[model samples]
Target: MTRSRAQTRLMLAILGAVFAFLYVPISVLFALSFNEGGLPTAWTGFSTKWYGELLRNADIMGAAWNSLIVAVASTVIATVLGTLLAIGIEMRRRKGRLVETLVFAPMIIPDIVLAIALLSMFSLAGVRMGLHTIIVSHVVFNLAFVCAVVRARLRSFDWSIVEASTDLGAPATVTLRRVILPSLLPAVIAGALLAFTLSIDEFIIAFFTAGAGRSSITLPMQIFAMIRFGVTPEINALATIVMTLSLVMLAISQRLNRGSLPGQ
Candidate 1:
């Protein structure tokens, strides 16, 4: 009985320590966001002044708008292409390893390498680097994510039903429209949400691809520039808001997926 009690105590102690380690920093950050004096070292009661300042800051709003455009465009492109790619690849009886590798290449490749490669390609082709370039770059990686996510949804997909529809004189278009797409809807939306979150938060690629102007800057780029000037109360408010948006999107994606093993 004593040994069991000691083990329970030890387990609780370890879990308690882990929880504190994970959350203490977040707790501090949340507290600092509301600090009236705009200083982390000392709290001078709660205030929403920093958030108000963030709203009134035109430069910040410009960057935020740019990010929204990039994220929205990328997500839309990725969702369409990724859904189609998933269907095409899964329809085959034997999946090609080469095709799989090509689709997933962006996920594993170093971001710096992709960034430099895109820059070199654009420079050679005389494609002006700006918000459009950022959108194109985001689409490249975002498409990979959407494809992978939608592919997972297809693994356990009942192709026999599709065959049955076709065997009943349903055209390929009909099978896709009535049979395939409805089943993939959940994953399609999940992938789009995931892609949007990634594009919104992506910094390194956006920073490199955003050309030589503050005009085309994204929110992450703005945040990076702000951080270089040191921490401020307004920054805390901005960070809190961004983090909340990301967390909410993540929760939605998780809810869409039951996390079954692919093909199981």
Candidate 2:
């Protein structure tokens, strides 16, 4: 009993240390975001002026709007393509190793390498680099994530229902719309949310593809530019807001994913 108690204490200590290491800096940033002084080194009283400043900053708002557009467009495209790809792969009786590898390549590849490759591809194709390029880049990055999530859900799917529907004289489109899609709705939404979160947070790919202007700059790129000058209270406030949004989306995605699992 004494040894078990000691082990439990050690585990709790380790857990506490891990949490502190991960969150202490974020906690500091969060606190400083509300500081009236707007300085990281010293805290004056609490105030919401920094957040107000963020709202008023045209550059920040424009970048935020750009990010929203990229995220929404990429998530929609990735979700649709990924879902179709997942269904296609799952429907196949012989799932080849090469095909699996290709499907997972985007997720496995380093972000920097993927970003460079995408940039090169766009250049070679003579594509105009702008918000549209960023949207396309994000779609590429997010597609694998969406596919993986939907594929996991599909693993436990009851395909017998689909077969039964087909036997009942339903057309392919009818069966897909009325049967398969309804069952996969939760997972699809979860995948879309997850994709949106990834697209919003993605910086390297967006940066490479965004090309030559403030017009295509995303929120992460803007944050990077601002932090190069120094971490001000406005940056802190912006970070806090972005982090909160990401956490909320991730939490919802996780909940939906859990609920979609068999016998959950």
Q: Which is the leading candidate under lDDT?
A: 2
- The list of candidate 2 runs beyond 4 A from truth reads 261-263
* TM-score of candidate 1 on Cα atoms, chains taken together: 0.92
> 1-264 in candidate 2: lDDT tens per residue?
999999999999999999999999989988999999987778789999999999999999999999999999999999999999999999999999999999989999999999999999999999999999999888889888888999888988999999999999999999999999898988999999999999989999998899787899999999999999888889999999999999999999998898565566
| Top-scoring candidate (TM-score) | 2
TM-score of each: 0.92, 0.97
Q: What's the residue-level lDDT of 3 in candidate 1?
A: 100
| Candidate 1: worst-modelled 10 consecutive residues by lDDT | 255-264
lDDT at 92, model 2:
97
What are the per-residue Cα lDDT tens digits for candidate 1 across 1-264?
A: 999999999999999999999988877887899999998788899898889999999989999999999999988998999899888988888988899899999999999988888888888999888999999999998888998888888888888999899899999999999999898888888888999999999988888888888878999899889999898887888888888898889789767855523644
Model 1 misplaced stretches (Cα beyond 4 Å)? 1-19, 259-264
